[model samples]
Target: MSLQYFAGAACRALTARKDGPSLYEVCDPILRQPGSGGDPHLSKFYRTALGNPALRTLLRRAGLPELNDPARLNALRQALVLARDNPTPDWESVGGPIAELVDGITLQHPAPPRRTGAVAMPPAAEIDRVIRACGADLLGSYGRNGFIPTYAAFNLIGDPDIRGREVLMALQGLDARGYKNSTLMFNLARVFIARSPAAAVINPPWRGIAEPMWEPVQIRHRSAYYDAFFTEALLSYLETGLASSEQTGTARAAIAAMVDFCLETSREEVRGADGKSYHVVTALAPPPHPRFSRFFTQIKQDLGFGVYVPDCDTTACSFSAATQAGSNDPILDQPLVDFYAGYQVRAGGNEPRVTVPINDNIDYEGGVATWIDSMAGERPYGNDLDPTLNLDVLEVSFRNLTRWQILETEARLAFIRRIVGFQQRLVLSGAFADPRAHIYYLPELYCAYFGRCYHAFMALPPAARQAIDPGGAFELIRLRVLAYVEDELVGREMNPFDAALALIALGHLGGNEASFAPAVHCIVTAFGEGGRRHPYRAYEWNKMKTPTRILVGGPEVTSAFVLMGLALARRCR
Candidate 1:
């Protein structure tokens, strides 16, 4: 329940499902390990012995027949009879040959399998130390002067950031010539690292910043789609981390530049809501920089990169950033509020569609659609409801306080009503764990925002809660959220991906940490021993046209989440 280790990341995991690896398949690498990485009380592996693909593959390849039960799970009551032996071989004499075969033979499956040697899982305490150290190295070594990636691509052993869309290479002047710069990572990273315990060990990365960060110019929705909230994160960064530093004035100007980029580029449109039309910031504002003038503003016209109109995702985040940066402009009043508020799906109207690969959208009407234009227009996009963005809207609606409150009373209440309505839809439909109910973000990322919202909801006074919800609307569902996380712990602890999300959810929900010691040890020992975990696909090929799926995010951000979970675990201990 400690707010000190409350984990937050504006991290995104985007992908358009093109059918390659399931989330479980990506998790196959570590789950097959021989022991509970070191805890003896726990099982040697997360799942049962029959499911260890690598071991079975190894046995098959060595010309030894595997146990051929219907489930491949058998107990040898008499003895392990290897009939291939010329004569009866003693157990002691056969050890060397078996050890030699099993030591480092490569497995065919598991995508990029590791050539593991004699396994001695690291002790629990050692694993814990390694978890902290890995987090330390991730932040201190790379995060010290680097930008976090939007997609945490799990390229564990291959070349790092293989897509060439990284600011890290751009900063280092490496081979990444056409570096696809991110609009939000630097600011987001600053916020995450600063808030985490890692800040105590390393110097602030944005200490000397004085320039407005660039818009997400290189990234194309139709043209340069902008992200401004990571800028707000930067503003939060400068105000909290370096207010008295000499770079304060420069920092403000840099922040203003990005905020202005968001403001000036917003599409001012008259949208109808509450039976009236209001001029709101409809579209994401690209930077006014003339260098990118060739990029088209009328997004519907461009058929090349697929049409990405203004969405609740961008509008809500951009509006939140604007409010935080001290803007009292009228755009924050009716137009923007009503425009977004008008988009939430009406109750009982969400028809089932299987467009996204993650989950079924059954009875999701209260949720907000991804894009404003509902594909009826010339531009073909919309009808997809994203839980991640809904939570983002919910997060800003509360702004770390109890009960959703923003904008004028009438519009704000209307907005909060729909926001809460969609939240109910997500939980009741059982889609919250399905990649945050979409293909673009991980369940972990969704939990990160959900945790914040839950924390804020808990802050409400009892009277205030009763007045708002009337009948304790969220009380039963809150238990559901906690139970869902606890259910995950009951299953086999797979990889750091599951562990990270489970630990963070429990921490946010104020659950007892002692209940999930095995999973915690799994995370600690995985890092303590192998010292390797690539970014598993948090999201997939969100592009309009692509044969193969494209994943994002790097190991550095992956390590940060692991570290965040470890921090909370340490506090509980």
Candidate 2:
């Protein structure tokens, strides 16, 4: 559709909001449209209009302010100029006053009565059904060599901690399955490792075979791009699982070997114009693997092998290096360095903090493209980058590391604040439009952040917790939960996974039982026939055509998230 079509759709969506328009309502239409699909000139023109400070204020204040009327737009612009020049323009005092229209829109739902203890647990049969459904998905999707098809398998295994003999038996059945790639195998191993250490020692189903296959000798020759971090993480888990000294020794040797191999293949020494030598990990090596670049920076950071040193003022240093590197592509260099430096700062101090400047050079509408270019780096699928998704994953990773004492307290809180800041900008800039009014991806993001926040508050020292505003974070989460309830529960967006995640966050926030009961019931009822499978996508409300299909995590991802929600609920109780 043309820009007008998109703009008109946004306006309709915004004004239709009973609780006043959210920033997402205005941005959703534009975001959903493919970047190259719309009229280039018209898209740019509308972006300029939205970028105008006066027009933006009007749009935010009065929904989409009669964008088609040039006279009204001009009048707003003139008034803004007068206000600037006259310091305090007495427009309110003048007889020719602009009417202030307030909708009195409020999106808040009454808080449910805070549970003194855990809410009632789901029936034993119900829990059993969920466990079975998840197990079936896991077993059904198992590829040869014990690998599952999607990253969701990691979530399934990682999040719930995969207890129960029945689920273990289901996993045991995949022992003979073969992996076509290291990614799948490493993930599969990770799942097994996350199980009880006793289970590994007593029932060693895939361990004997998988351990031999992952021998340092076998993996040493593999490309660093494909195997380094995955191999290291896999071995780390293997060391934890195998109780025997010999087996654990093997795992440790393999880890060291893989680390050395990565350094040899991925590291490059270069002399800058300042005649100083620096070692940095190349994004990829010769004979590139397809998935190489996507994980390059992450793997290097995970393995502790990057030019930027941890715990130093790496932010300034990395940014300086990017400038000195003299790369023709500043757009790519700048964001990549920022991400790298941010992580380094996070890794260095007990309280790691780095600031990522929201580019003012690109207006709100164009920020999406700029964010993609900067953040995605050399990845070919730059346009497909989802800021919410990236931030969610990053926040979770930071939280997990901090919990393990691998990351300092400051690092975890700093990273979380940065992510929250990014989300706040999207809301303020009016770039987070979702016609469904849930911001579509926001519940998931809020769940991730709030979940982390909850755990951090409980686990960190009081002083550390005080450094971050737990109440403010909860307020943001509570508002999003209300939106989720309105759109997904009371309304019909109906994504059980997202709902389940939101439920978990709400429980953590001490949400009143009444407010979240309907959501819990909705999720419980979503259990398909026999509870053997759940639909991969939520059915849209009123047959509304979603801009994109709901992301599929199959049964494994769905059941895992549901189980996690249940687990969280039980904990809260």
Candidate 3:
């Protein structure tokens, strides 16, 4: 019998065996007793099949031919067990036998064909209507800085009413749920608040909503990119106030606290058990206190954010000569010597420094965190991870600030521009476009970014396209990606996430006219054969069914760009 039949019959055998030749027909059973047949091994295997439909299908399809030899079943079962270890598989490694069963099923039960032809976009009037509607719906949800119960009293409402007392309450749950990326929300809100006419006078409800999420940024051991949003938000807040006479003093004080924290916590000077001291670098470079001082000076004048460190100011010194090894000697290689002199050295003049390749400290090895840890000191990993104010941290700290003194409209606009500018230069520049362009054997959110840049360009005047050519830029990028996917080195199938993003990009670049047929062809081929059914609609695609849950936007890359693309298509249609 097939495994499906055997499993079904085996289940039936527990009761009502008299009705059928075997225990095959027992769909509806009359239970005389409470207990089960209780075959532990069979029960375990049955439970496994019930729990995993994909496994059951593969196993059932294999049937008696494979299971007749018990060892093969055992081997298959072991593979199934190992498959569970990787819940979200990286590739199609677990699909050899499963593919056979799936293909057989496809032959037996033909599925419906996929839709083709240009999907119509809503008209310009409709898009404007929706955009206005969305804006109106969202406007009421925001306050100066944070969300407040509609009923909160005046003191609870605090200054800049958006940020005041309401922010403190929201901070508790800011990162409580799956919303781990509160920093983004906070900074986005801060930008809006700094520039918003209403928000300048009061914080915004989203500010309070975003503050507590900044807790992780103080982790000096982590990359500086983590807290970049907070830094931008705080800078925006300060600059906005600086432009206004009323709130400038408070903004400067906040900025000072942030700069002080960055300068103090980022340096690593520690004393070993012996009398000797060890000095380490922890920042992008060494302590830029003087540079930071100048940066603050410029900020005090309200110039704007710029890179503080041009080069490492840490005392440039050489490693001890005694540590050179056979062929692996770093000292022998001048480039390597220059790069890692501080991380390597001979302990004693006579003793060989290179006994083994391992560095002195195992836990805090001189990897990415090494430089930052050196600046932060010995208690880098533990609770001593500065739980205080950097410019970013101040954004969170001031989240608890109930009253925010309001400012003028022009001041607010300048504030947001400065923050966006800071983020653009310092943080977003590294991640401006789709990062997936670097790695795409398996596709990600390239299409998303493609859509965004396209949307932005399309929104500009038709003449603007002549200069910016955002659409053409996206087309070139999309072509490059298609080339990479077709490469022999990347033998990966496009999942639904990739397909959705690709469709968006292609649809945007292609538009209503048939001029974009080539891009459209790329999308269809990536997902299906001649717009027929897709072969692999596996779990990854199933998980991607909900847009909000799959990723912050899509796995493609740039959120701002992708959002813009989707919005533009929706709007322009």
Using TM-score as the measure, which candidate wins? 1
- lDDT: which is higher, 1 or 2? 1
Looking at candidate 1, the ten consecutive residues that score lowest on lDDT are 175-184
Across 154-205, the per-residue lDDT of candidate 1 in tens digits comes to 1111111111122121222211111111111121122222222333222211
Error of 2 at 421 (Å): 3.7
lDDT of 2 by residue, 29-141 (tens): 54223244322322232333233454343233333334235664345334333422343234332101122111111112122232233234456456445544443343343
* lDDT score for residue 529 of model 1: 28
Order the candidates by TM-score, highest first: 1, 2, 3
**Which structure is stronger by lDDT: 1 or 3?**
1
Cα RMSDs, all models = 20.1, 20.7, 23.7
What Cα-based lDDT does every candidate model obtain?
A: 0.40, 0.33, 0.25
Model 1 TM-score, 2 decimals: 0.49
